[model samples]
Target: MVFLKTLAYITLVLPLVVYLILNKRNNNKPSRVIFYYLVYSIVHEILVYYLTNFTDNISDSNAIPLLYAIFTIIEFFFLGYYIYDSLKNKLFKKVLLLCSIIFLITALINLFFIISSGVNNQLIDTIPVSTSAILLIIFSILYLFEEIQAPKIGFIYSNPKFWIIVGIMIYFTGTFFFFLLFSDLSGKDQYNYWIINLICIILKNIFFTISFFLPLENENSNEFDSSFGINHYNTIK
Candidate 1:
């Protein structure tokens, strides 16, 4: 358990390190939404650990859940924006927007009405987490389909977005049921099974780091790809 926790922390930072190195080498896109998300993640984890263990003025019981409730919204926003930006299909874009607005409403209601109101007894609110997982999984798959049907690069996996989407796909798929079942699981079971989440986190971060190494040829809001060992896009006219 301790080792897995340590490993998870390491995995979370690895991508950030890779991103910074790539940037210095002029191997990264101008926009750094992924970098911002990585920083947000590390900060949230630290805050959770501190609030749960050290903070005394605040009620200990609600701290972590409250943090998660709020951070979960931002979490979805970043990943959703990434997918939305990567996609080009007009109908699909509209669907993504509508689903996002619906999710925002539902997640906000869950945060304010249930988690913060003290009307609910559960330590963690599963609704936001579960809903976000489902939406992200579906959208990730859609992005994958869009990429497959009209690929920009010679080899599909050469694209950085491919790695990013796969990371999101694998993480949400692996943890979807675990998070949905969180509220019902016994303390012992939760403790024993939490490693599954940790493993998925590690895998997601590993893939994210790989994506950073392969910079997108077009993070310029013009989605394109770079082949392996190449950093710039090649045009054949």
Candidate 2:
């Protein structure tokens, strides 16, 4: 477990460092989504480390898992934004909008479930688990579309779209296992949960790294991106 945990840590951080370095060299900057996720991963790692050591007060550390959920929301925002941008066709655009709506509806449902269950303290944690699962599903369908059409809208998986699918598969699979390991009734050990987190962290980073390297068409093309418009280089310049 210790070895696995260490491996997970390395996988998680290494990709982010590589992305940052590569972006800097290219005179580009990392996205806010990447920045947020990276910071979240680091904090999550530290919390999990303490969690492994702080056995006596495990319940009190519920906030740790909740924090994971919070990051999940951020993750959704990031991926959803990317998906929206990568899509080009009018039909796919509608599908993309529909997916976003489904995710919004699912998120609200999950929120209600959390509140009704009276796990308000664990609200953040629950949100991420459910959201991550839903996001993965949604992304999978999108990848399928890309695969079927074989269109070159400038995604890492543009040529085959299989690479993005693989990344999504790894990411979704990682999140599912992590959720199961940490669910209130999983009966798993702390180390098991950490192992799951480690998997999630690594897989997710891999997804993001692949995404960064994947070619993007009209990266400056999104009108909705006014929220975070302007590349890092533009800002620095």
Off-target runs (Cα >4 Å) in candidate 1 are 24-31, 57-60, 119-121, 151-153, 218-237
Residue-wise C-alpha lDDT for candidate 2, range 141-235, written one tens digit per residue? 76566645642335444422244446556666665755654546444454456666567656766666665555433434523343345354367
- Tell me the TM-score of each prediction against the true structure: 0.86, 0.63
lDDT of 1 at 157: 79
lDDT of 2 at 150: 47
Model 1 local distance difference test score: 0.81
C-alpha displacement of 180 in model 2, angstroms? 5.0
Give each model's whole-structure lDDT. 0.81, 0.57
Q: Give me the candidate number with maximum lDDT.
A: 1
**Would you list the clashing residue pairs of candidate 1?**
none
